[model samples]
Target: NFEGTFNTGAYASWGPTVANRVPVHASGPYFIENYRAKSYAVHTNTPSSGAFRGFGVPQSAIAQETAFDLLADKVGIDRLEFRIRNALQNGLPTATGQIFEKGVGIKECLEAIQPHWARANAEARAFNAKANGSVIRKGVGLGSCWYGCGNTSLPNPSTIRFGIKADGTIVLHQGAMDIGQGSNTVITQIAADGLRVPVHSIKLIDGDTDLTPDCGKTSASRQTFVTGKAAQLAGEALRRQILRKANVSEAASLEFSDGLIKAYEGDTSVEIELTRLEPNAFGYVFMAEETYDPPVKALDEKGQGMPYAVYGYGAQLMELSVDTKLGTIKLDRITTAHDVGKAINPMLVEGQIEGGVAQGIGLALMEDYLPGRTENLHDYLIPTFGDMPEFVNLIIEVEDAEGPYGAKGLGEHVLIPTAPAILNALRDATGVIVAALPATPDKVMAALMAHNEE
Candidate 1:
């Protein structure tokens, strides 16, 4: 059973949305015989609780995973081993009763990190065994996450438009904002692949209302899956039009250059002059606008349905040392294994993982919101580059049938496991469980004192 109460402040902003989303994700990616989840939005006299990276799921995961640690200890099973055994596999239904026949990769992620978990724990034990009269103790812990790719049983759709001008220059009017998540690069790559053209040959336009279509808002890690699918469809539509005009077979190869198109299939070649053709009212000889709404079904009163068509899965292992006296944690390493369906851009995925890990550090050790009392940057701390540890990334791919080129969402999944992993590591170093956000030095010291007294 899972229950959550959120202090959605004065305005209540996205409280209802979050209230609905948390319960659906509260189950994580594990299988249970039965579970009931309820969420309450309590009015508070604090700042407005707006949307963050993981919505309310991160907080729910922190509570759930921390509880799992206690359960694992009580059952005499290693924490990582316990999760792997219980990790949701293919054909296992979710809390919503949505059973995926394929594209379920939580168990794969947990298994992928097994070697890393072994190494981290071995190093920690060896270091702790030799720590005689030392104030520092090493510990390692694991955390896993599974995130649905879109909104919770809502009508969220993405539309993309692309057209070839008389000069043969392709202008892709995409509405999905980049927001530093590499949507521009990812969407363009998908579009290019679908259109059978070079990425650089196509021009991308975003945030321009007059030129771009409504590609939906940039959240829930939906751009790569939703908007990208739309872009792929649009590109295919435009390619089909060109093929029809040339009277070429579907197997024909395409070549797009300035003011012309060349279609070749075995000895049959067809050329279309772009400059000679009449332009449409949108000022393009050929254009395609396609919309893709991820298949979803509204949950019943019991919150059961296909809330999201695709989901991302991940596991992470963190190794750190806790200064028993100072209650400070020094990071040593972190290994993250995630099933992204497919990586459209490997470097961007790595950047996302590293950035998410940094945010996870803040959520685990700092970045506490104190409402009225905490007004300045000094009051709220964040992690910097100097705070990062040795990072290892393991990209897992379990292709989704609905995704474009077998690509799923990666933005939110990377951060969900971070905070819990850090807290679990802290618990390993000092037999104290911190389910709360931002385990500050004072809180750590207090928990340590309690452990010592016990």
Candidate 2:
């Protein structure tokens, strides 16, 4: 049984949303049949609480994963093996009672890092065995995550609009906001595939309501899964129009030259002269608009239904050393395996992983907000370049039929497992559990002192 009380702060904001989401995802992407979770949100005299990355799941994960470690100790099983044995598979049901017929990759994610787990743990054990009462000791920790890609059981839609002009100018009106997550690039790549044109050929337009279509908001990691699909459809719609005008089959290869489209199939070829065609109201020879909404079912009061069409899963193994004397933790390395369905851009995927891991570092050790006093960046610390650990990125592809070209939402999934992995590693290194957030040097020193006394 799991119960959570969330301080919603001075106003509502996403307090109710956080309350609703915590219970559904608190189980840490594993199979939990005899599971029960409840959350209560109460107003406090602080700032209003809202979505802080994992939408309250990160706090729950930090507790849940550490609890798993304790349970593994009582059962006399290796923590990694214990998790692998009960990892969720293709036919299992989540805490929400939603069954996925396919696209379940949590087990794969856990297994992907198995080889490293043994090697890293052996090294840590060897190093600590030689520590012989030294202030520094090494330890390894494991954490995992499973997150839905879009709105929970709500109608979230994205539309992509594009057109071909008589002058052979191909313009794609991308509506998805690129809030540093690379929506602008990822969506364009997916659309480019459908249109059979190079990415450079498509002139992209965004942030202008008068020019762009309604591709929906950039939250919940929905731009790639939802907006990308819409972009694909829009490209196909225009391609079909061109094929019809050329009186050619869908299998025909298209070549754009000057202001004309050449459709060629075997020995037959047809040229679509753009100058002979009439422009539409949007001032294009052919224009197409398409929308994609992920399929979902609303949850009843019991909170059971198909909340999301696609889910992203991953696991991370953290190796670190704890300076028990000074309460300073130094990350050695982090090996992460995530099921992204497809990586439209491998560089962007890696960047997202690194960025997420940076945030996780802050959440685990450095960042602390003291309201009036620690309001500024200097007061509240963030992870510096020196704080980042060496990363071994392993990309897992478990294609979901719902995503565009088998790409799922990855923005939030990368952050979910990070803090949990770090905290678990802290425990492994020093044999102490941090019962609170920001795990500052002072708190860690105190915990170490109390443990030493015991």
Instruction: Please tell me which predicted candidate would have the highest lDDT against the true structure.
Output: 1
TM-score of decoy 2: 0.97
What number of clashing residue pairs does each candidate have, in the order they appear?
0, 0
| lDDT tens per residue, model 1, 295-384 | 999999998899999999998889999999998988889999999898989999998999888888898888988766887888888999
Q: Candidate 2 at residue 406, lDDT?
A: 87
lDDT of candidates 1 onward, in order: 0.89, 0.88
Angstrom error of the Cα, residue 329, model 1: value is 0.6
All candidates: TM-score: 0.98, 0.97
Question: Predicted candidate 1: what Cα RMSD to the true structure?
Answer: 1.1
Clashing pairs in 1: none
Question: Candidate 1: misplaced stretches above 4 Å?
Answer: none
